[model samples]
Target: MILLKCFMVIFVGQFLDVTSVYNPMLTYNIRFNKLRFLPNVTGNYTIFQQKDKQYVSGYIQRPTTDEVNKYQLPVFHRCNPEGLNCEYFQSWTLTDLCTLLKDKNQIWSKWYGAFDPPILCPINQYTYVFRNSTGEVNIFLKWYPDVLNYQWKITQKLYSGDFYIGSYYNPMLTYVVRIVKITSYPNITWNYSVDTYKGKYYVNGNTSITTDKLIDKVVGVFERCAPEGINCEYFQSWTLTDICPKLLDKNQIWSSWYGRSFDPPVVCPINKIHYQIRNGTFDLDPIIKIYTDATNYYWKLTQKMYAGNTLVGSYKIETVFLGLSRIDDEGGVVSTDPSGLAYSPERSRL
Candidate 1:
């Protein structure tokens, strides 16, 4: 089965321009509600392969705790000889990875460099803090072959200057190594030091830090960067979760472009709940947000909502526009509507 699958992947590799597909191996969009701005995030590479004498691609997302164990997919752990045992990689060949990215136009030269790093595996974690010849900064992290035991799994975090922070699980190692990307030089430089034992995680080469203190610093950074009124909270490195408390807050004044206008409501079949929002263009924003919930499936009737000229809330309904299909090759979708019009509602918050 493995060999046959490999042949299929390699065969498909020949005909398909993976780069032309414009699919980043792993893409993440980060947003801060407080900022009143769109999300800004980049892709990361995890598995780089060579096929047909060309590079192919593979990548993984840094999943939350729940994502680590729920799926039946093959899991990777530190116990795995090469670090991560990724099964999805079966679809990609090496030639698919090395194709150069087309978008090289950076706003500044300091930001110019490889958009995605050349991935060479066998490690638990991979990170990049790129400072181009001009000194623009972009940070990225990738973890593959899921770490089975989050406890003993060690990762590294690099920052500006010669700073390296190790997510080391073994306290006894005593010698902690930090890799720093020198702004003056693109190459990584390393330093080793003893443990001072302070925060949940230590500063680059700072031995004495605990995770709690590390989290505190991250929260501080987020608060400073996030826009006002949006509640910013630490979610992970390079990302924060912002709660629009005011959007649902009772005490705050509500200000929508059309707050006084009537809201159209749509009925969701799965939960038997009605979704309501302002009419027209304002309706589009919330619908896209709900449709993009790839995990918790849902849908909306874009056609009916538009035809009825009703102000519909962001309710999940039977909609064909949101890519719900009757025969999904990649099973596990919660859709049950035979007509493919109905969508499974997200877990009801109410």
Candidate 2:
């Protein structure tokens, strides 16, 4: 294997810093989007310089793994020219090989065949992009992906100059921008549904997946945004609508609807506590009787009523209250009494 001598050039301010030791006699092309870019190699081939001192430099035709698979190509290597026996091309990816060529200006030539493409991406290509001071430009090239770094080894094809073919080991292709660094979770927000039934309002909290105390973080981020003397207004509501209607309905309808009767029409306080009567019995069946009075105040018809958390008596009151008298005093009221009325949860409390 004869190593080609290539000179490095650096351009500054649209001017060459040094004259070319060799002419722009370099061209390289690669086959891409196919199984393999070159023919399979069965035996070793010789690669040597024109003389012991005289040199030739050109890009090797490296192929992508996908291209090798598509073309059914075999792998080949540019062995040492002196021995031409040991194989040295089996370990490198197309991308890694390309980096070594450009950085160190070393070249490896393929004698009879080209490198095989790996199985990950079964395609063939013949072009790759290169960057000089002016920027990236496409040249005829071949490359393979590096399994370790997801990069490619590349070889340039001689499109215009003396076809001096060789290959070299290089780092894979890379970009500062193409590489993304995700430091934190993504920013996302959600919308929820709201519903109201009767006087109760309901809202669906964050039921989907995640919840964050972003509001607390916001206060910290914008500590100066709040006024010096006033508290932060983030937690207060502007409307009292949720509870007002329900409160009014309970007050007007539930406060006075249930009660036992007295001859003088005994008045009860609006806030007396009520209890549920579970097993109270009545003298008259189906009279909607309930026990009420100072000792047993409850609605006449309600099976359950509040008696300071204790039921009044073992007996249930008749549903009907005599027009202006007690049941024991009026010989018990009949179920047909016009005053047997039903009340709501709020009103029946005594």
Candidate topping TM-score: 1
Q: Model 2 scores what on Cα lDDT?
A: 0.21
Alpha-carbon lDDT of model 1: 0.20
- Tens digits of per-residue lDDT for model 1, 109-186: 222243134222222233333211121112211222222111121111212122211111111011111111111111
CA displacement after TM-score superposition, residue 3 of candidate 2 (Å): 8.6
TM-score to native of every candidate shown: 0.18, 0.14
Report every candidate's CA lDDT: 0.20, 0.21
Candidate 1, residue 149: the lDDT equals: 17
Tens digit of lDDT per residue, candidate 2, span 4-66? Answer: 211111010111222222223532122111111112111222222232222112222343323
